[model samples]
Target: MLEVVAVCDAILHSPWLLPVLVVLIAIDGPFPVLPSETLLMSAASVAFGTHNALAVTGLFVAALIGSVAGDFLVFGLGRSSHRVLARATECEGGLSSWVRRHLLLRPGTVLVGARFVPGGRLVSTAAAGRFGLDVPRFLVGSVASSAAWSVYMLLIGLLLGPITGGSPLLSLLAGAVMAVLTAGLFALVQRVRAYRARRALAAAQHPTEPPLVLVAPR
Candidate 1:
């Protein structure tokens, strides 16, 4: 663990930080394994220790570009797989239908919200492409979400900086834990909403029967 921490610290201070950040975050788009959120935040936390404001700016730029590029890649993949969506859907109102309906109704919402959710970025971006969200709109959403994600991550790091003394490993662990909790909360909220929607649909389809009125004497 100590050795790993030393390595993380070394990498954080390495000259190749920016390039590595770009690569990691870019791949992070399609693959959740390297989403780079915690790494970015840990870097920001180091920024406080290093007291280099310029580094933070550069980090934000790299993260923003990388994440957007990653999302674009996924979007392209989805676009390329038009045949899959071309087939008839199995259900009229399950996840696929819900995604399509929301993407149509609120593309920005879907794109932006998905960025913060674990594994959501790829799914939403792919859905957008598969469902025919145009390039321009996708670009707008990608940029918006990336920028927002970058800012949010920096703030988390900054907030955790004081406690960790800006230690890279500590910050990384803290950021990862925070992100996991946040992602879990987000997933829970979404699940609750879906459950409610399902319940409403079921009720509408088959409402409960009213109490029987036996008024034979009347």
Candidate 2:
């Protein structure tokens, strides 16, 4: 653990960290396991103390660009799977059924909000591509979300500096813990929602018959 912390501290203090941020953000676009937010926060804390505002701004821009590229790549992959997804949508089962039951009819809402929600981000993007969303529209929504996410992380990092005593490592760790908790909470909510949805479907399909009316004999 000490070695890891030392390594993290070294990296946080390194000049090369900015490029590393770009690659991490790219990976994070499709995979939630990567803590891109934490990285940005850490970099921001360092920049705050060093008075390197340009680094902070550059990091945000790099992250945003990487995210946009990553989302587009995943969206393209999803488009390639269009035939399979279409078949699944027709079957009224699995993720397709859940999406149809829960999500709005308009694809734009899904495209815009997916990037804000955990798990939903990449999945919804892929779904949009699979559903034949216009490439231009999809790119527009993706750019918007990526920009918002980048700015949010940068600000969070800057704000966290004072809170963590300008310790970039601690701030990064806290952000990572928060991300993990957020993901866990999302998973729990999804499980409960899925259970409720399944129960409702079952009740609708096989509702208990009303108690038989007993004829009173005079």
Candidate 3:
């Protein structure tokens, strides 16, 4: 515990922490930085232990600004290829299809919901632009999702503080486990939903087609 405290103390005092946090979350693609979530959780856990309201506030503010900035960049990238993307996704299925058949119809829900899904953030934001979703609507969804996700992650760090004896490292490790489980659960739900949608689509396409059944072999 002493060692953990010392390490966290050093990290919290580091002048580079906040700058690094903002930079990492604001930029995307080939850069060697710890996952933004990990850094945020680390800072949050330490703040939780020390009751550093400033740190928590900083994390939230950084996350909000950085996330929206990054997302806007991706959105712009997608917008640049808007015409090509629209042509490419004219058919149904895949991300392109989702953007056309679904996402286009429910911009706000998909944008907000995507924040919780792994890789969903970039994909959805990009799709929004690729599909030419209204800028005003996108901004609303972007801010809302960023706020919700920041709070969600901070809450995880805070909840783990006491459980890990106020050790930021332990809280970070525990938070990683929780994050993985949460991501896995979300992924599973997405897969299941996709599978069901496929099945329904198939059924509609072939009303007279026989259903397949499987049996275990000895």
Candidate 4:
């Protein structure tokens, strides 16, 4: 806790912190392990302590822009090399096999929910690119979602100020909770995917099985 507070104080006082924050957000859009929310919350807490409202707002906007830019870039890459990516991954077979075996078959909720899950954001973004979703629509959704996420984290930090006696303990606790929740959600989603895949395989293997006949005759 002392270490976290020290780091936060340094970032808030440093001149290069804003640029570092932007870089971290950008990298997080392509890499799943960056923990964008923790960074945002930490930055927000620092800004709150220093009364730097403008800097805090800028950080949020920058994060949203970075997310949209990265997502769009991947989308374009997916579009341009659709054939190559498909061939490389063996589109019809390997891709489908992965989707089934790893429980990525149904991505509807997962795609939207990924923005909230640590380590899942990039995977979901890459999956969206691979699936050929409309770029403009995706950008709109990403911007909105990223902005909302940024604000939520900032609020978390502000709220923690009162609860933890102005300590950084709340920020660390929030990060831990987010991590645990994300892991649980990911596990549940995979389970659902597995169940769905098994059902599909069973149906395919026994297509000719007649429906059970309910006989009321004597």
Candidate 5:
């Protein structure tokens, strides 16, 4: 246990930590298995250990830059896929129609809304490229999304660090709980929005049938 704790401490204080964070977050956009949020929160927990404002700021900057870069990278990949294939492939447009209807309809909501959704960021960014969405518009949305995500992750770590007294294990457990709750909340919100959208679409398409009337006696 002592050795394990020692290794964790060394990693938290290591000079390579911040750079590693940037790389992880950058790759996470294309490959989500990396657990970018978990890493960011852990870094925030470490920052809280020092009670230093600069630590939080450093993390925010690194995460933001990494996330934005990754967004553009995936966008490029999508664009290349479309160009090479001469059509929108499944990977590029798999969820795009749904995104356009339920999520991407509004410029401001695209990035911010998708950030909370699972696999949403990947699909949205890729779709932008696949559909040839304007570069400047996509970049603006990406920036907003990445910044919000970084801030939220950092706040989770900072809050849990103090609560758990900087114990890595405890902080991790608490962070996991919070992450789950946040995901569930977002999912619920999405489901409700989707349901409403479906209903509205149905109503618009079908309209209401006129009531039947019988006048045989007359």
Candidate 6:
């Protein structure tokens, strides 16, 4: 493990590493399962320890570009495949409905927030395209989301890296753990919010009936 960490630390400082990192992050949008976040954080950690401003900046730019690029790619897919995809999937309507009702109202907030949720970024971007959200508005939200997400993961890695005395592996592991915990917390909150919304909706639809007067029975 220590040997692996040492090798990673060495590579993180390589001149060609930044560009590769950028590509990985950029394409990760279409592939949410990619370890884009992991790479970003890991690179940030190395940069932090070495005080490499160039590497740090490069990682940030790469991540931001990758995120936005990937989002737009998915957005385009949604536009072209909306009908077919919707017809093919059982949950399409529900997903689209949720995005339209919650995400479209304030596209910027939801876009940034969605990046924190597992599989949410892809869903939100695709929904935005499929549901006819304004392109300019969606792009604006995309920029914000990309910036916030890139900064967040990078910063977490940067903080954790130094604590481990510049151990890339340890920093990456710590950042991953934090990311998982954060995602879980966000999911729990969303569930609670959804439950509350459902309950409120149900109450509004069915008010309690008043009791009939007993004297009328005579």
Top-scoring candidate (lDDT) = 1
Which structure is stronger by TM-score: 4 or 6?
6
Tens-digit per-residue lDDT, 1-218, candidate 4: 66765675565457776676677777666555664556566566655655668977887776777666766655565556555434432344323344323324434444445556444455555656676566655666667666766677777667554544433545455544655664788778767777887889898998876789898989
Note the Cα lDDT for every prediction shown. 0.78, 0.69, 0.72, 0.59, 0.74, 0.74
Q: 173-216, model 1: which lDDT tens digit per residue?
A: 77778878888998798798789998998999999999998887
- Model 5: how far residue 209 lies from native, Å: 6.4
Which scores greater on lDDT, model 2 or model 4? 2
Error of 4 at 169 (Å): 7.5
Prediction RMSDs, each to the true structure: 3.3, 4.2, 7.3, 6.2, 4.5, 4.0
TM-score of each: 0.83, 0.74, 0.75, 0.60, 0.76, 0.77
Tens digit of lDDT per residue, candidate 6, span 5-118? Answer: 565556566776767766776677666666557657777876787787887788888888878888898888788876644442226333445666776688887788777777
- 88-199, model 3: which lDDT tens digit per residue? 4354554545655567678777777777877667667777887788888889888898888889878987876677666756765765677678778987987898899989
lDDT of 6: 0.74
- For model 5, residues 131-196, the per-residue Cα lDDT tens digits are 677888888899999999888888788788877777666655565578778778877876887788
Candidate 1 residue 102 C-alpha distance from true site, Å: 3.3
- Which candidate comes out best when scored by TM-score? 1
After superposition, the stretches of candidate 4 with alpha carbons farther than 4 Å from their true spots are 1-9, 49-52, 80-111, 164-218
Q: In model 6, which residue pairs have backbone atoms overlapping below 3 Å?
A: 26-66
Cα deviation of 71 in candidate 5 (Å)? 0.5
User: What is the alpha-carbon lDDT for the whole of candidate 1?
Assistant: 0.78
In model 2, the Cα lDDT at residue 194 comes to: 80
Q: What is the overall TM-score of model 4 with all chains considered together?
A: 0.60
